[model samples]
Target: MKKHNYSAGPCILPQEVFEKSAEAILNFNNSGLSILEISHRSKDFVAVMDEARALALDLLGLTGKGYQALFLAGGASLEFLMVPYNLMKENGKAAYLDSGTWASAAIKEAKFFGETVVVASSKEQNYNHVPKGYEVPADANYFHCTSNNTIFGTQMKEFPNLDMPIVCDMSSDIFSRVLDFSKFDIIYAGAQKNMGPAGTTLVVIKEEILGKNGKTIPSMLDYAKHIKAESMYNTPPVFPVYASLLTLQWLKKLGGIPAIEKINNAKATLLYTEIDRNPLFKGAAAVEDRSNMNATFLLNDEAHTPIFDALWKEAGISGLPGHRSVGGYRASMYNALPIESVQVLVDVMKDLEKKVSKTRL
Candidate 1:
């Protein structure tokens, strides 16, 4: 049986990426040393790091003049604190949009550092919709938002237009669509989703936004420090960086973000259409706020759960379970997930309907 994987992060990567990465791990770039054995400071590794950062910026249409791309060791979770540390000035405030768990966590982290104003929030709706038309404080240092909420299956389809700098955590849907890079002053994401494996976080920041916090920052936590050093202030996550570079190369070959966005929309449409048409299933998030990356749905009858479970498992499908906070099912159709995998899931849904109809006879 051909297996299909639908896990959210540390998720599926291209087969070619895995194959080439494995080969390079043993003897990278035809050099005798393994990728693991290569010194991060070595010229070859420096080139690798430079190219990876450059490719990421290029993919996002970022110009090096104002923007600096860094591959840092700490995940986006660390960025939840680093963002406020570098951008939030003394006696200054930052605005946040509380969409889901990660967004709430970021707000909590920012409070420990300085004052943060949650201008808008969706907790009242169980995070099923994005908050709209919030008032951004004119004195605010930056406005922060999570581009997509994985657990709640909601996304910020349109960002709020604010005069202040915009800081975004694009962890779930960074490269899944075309974004106007100019709108954001800083964008960060963990590479595990839609990029590559874990252990590295990518941050693209506008230089002017840094060095204004007026607070002494730890070297590792300072964005200005990393930007000035070209993300080489210390040894980096060499292997993950290399893999991320390869993934970026693959994305370019596949016609970049625009092409991928078309396919991503199609995959989401296919699954959501099935959910809407089926009597046995219903989508969890609001129609206007539904996420294209993570599609959450539920069985109409709780007793039918066992049947839905067996249907996918017997068909060699996997990782369709929803997060514990929001139960039912979540199909994370990340970039590397081929459209065929989604078709297979849809087929399973149709089969389940047929079985249920027979049971009613």
Candidate 2:
């Protein structure tokens, strides 16, 4: 049975990306050297790195607009600190919008550097809705937010128009939709979600936003230093970078972000429509704030859990289980997830409804 992967991170990638990556792993660039053994500074690897950076900006429509892209070793978790370290000035405060677990985590890291004021939060309702009507102070060094909440299945569909700089953790839905990338001063994402494997994180920083933090930052955490070295400050995640390059190449061939956004919307609509129509299940997040990337839902009646479980499992569905914090199902529909997989899940839901109907009769 073909597995329909819905795992949140380190999740499904394009089949062609996988095949090409596999070949490169064995003999990268037909150079007879395993990609695993290739040097990060090698000419071939350098080209891969360059292309990956270029493709990321091109997809976001930020190329040559004073924004620089970097592929770094630490995941988005590291960026949680690096963002504040490089941007948050000493005694200067930052505004954070708390929508989910990862957003809260980013807030925590920001507090370590300087003052971090949570302008608004949806935590009062278990992060089921995105916060709205928040006031961002102009004195803040930057306004930081997580563009999508993977754990709670919420996403910020409408971004705030802030006079201050805007920084975001787009880890879950970076390339899944179209956005005005110019509005963001910094955008960071872990590749595991929508880009590639789990070893690299993509960071796009507007060049002028650096060097204002006032504190001496470690070289590795300094965004300006990384930009100076062209993200070759230290040995990078070579294999993961190569794989990301292939994935980006595939995305370009598929006509870039605009094309993928349409497909992603279709996938999300299919899954969410089932969640709403199925009497057996209910959505976890607020309808307005519901994420197109991760759909969290639960069986309305826990007694039917076994039947529903069997239906999806027998249909070869994986990673539909929700986070421990939210005891339900979370179907993460990233850029690479096919609408057919969503149809399978929806069909299972409908089947469960039919079975229940006949049982009641």
- What does candidate 1's lDDT look like per residue over 1-361, in tens digits? 9888989888988888899889988998888888988999888899989999999989999866578899998899999999988888888898999999999999999998678899999898889888987888899999999999999899889987778899999999998999897789999999999888999999999888788778999999999889888888998889999999999999999999999999999999999999999999999999999999999999989899998899999988889999998899999999999999999999999999999999999
For model 1, state the Cα shift of residue 113 in Å.
1.9
Question: Model 2 scores what on Cα lDDT?
Answer: 0.92
lDDT digits (tens) for residues 1-361 of candidate 2 = 9999999988999999889888988998899999999999999999999999999999999988999999998899999999888888878898999988988989999899888999999888999999998899889999999999989999898998888889999999998899999999999999998899999999999999787667899998999999999889999999999889888888889999999999998999888888888778899999999999999999889999899899999999998899999988999999889999999999889999999999999
What is the Å distance of residue 306 in model 1 from its true position? 0.8
- Go through the candidates in order and give each one's C-alpha lDDT: 0.92, 0.92
TM for every model, in the order presented, reads 0.98, 0.99
Clashing pairs in 2: none
Give model 2's clash tally. Answer: 0
Candidate 1 regions exceeding 4 Å error are none
lDDT of 1: 0.92
Error in Å for residue 230 of model 1: 1.5
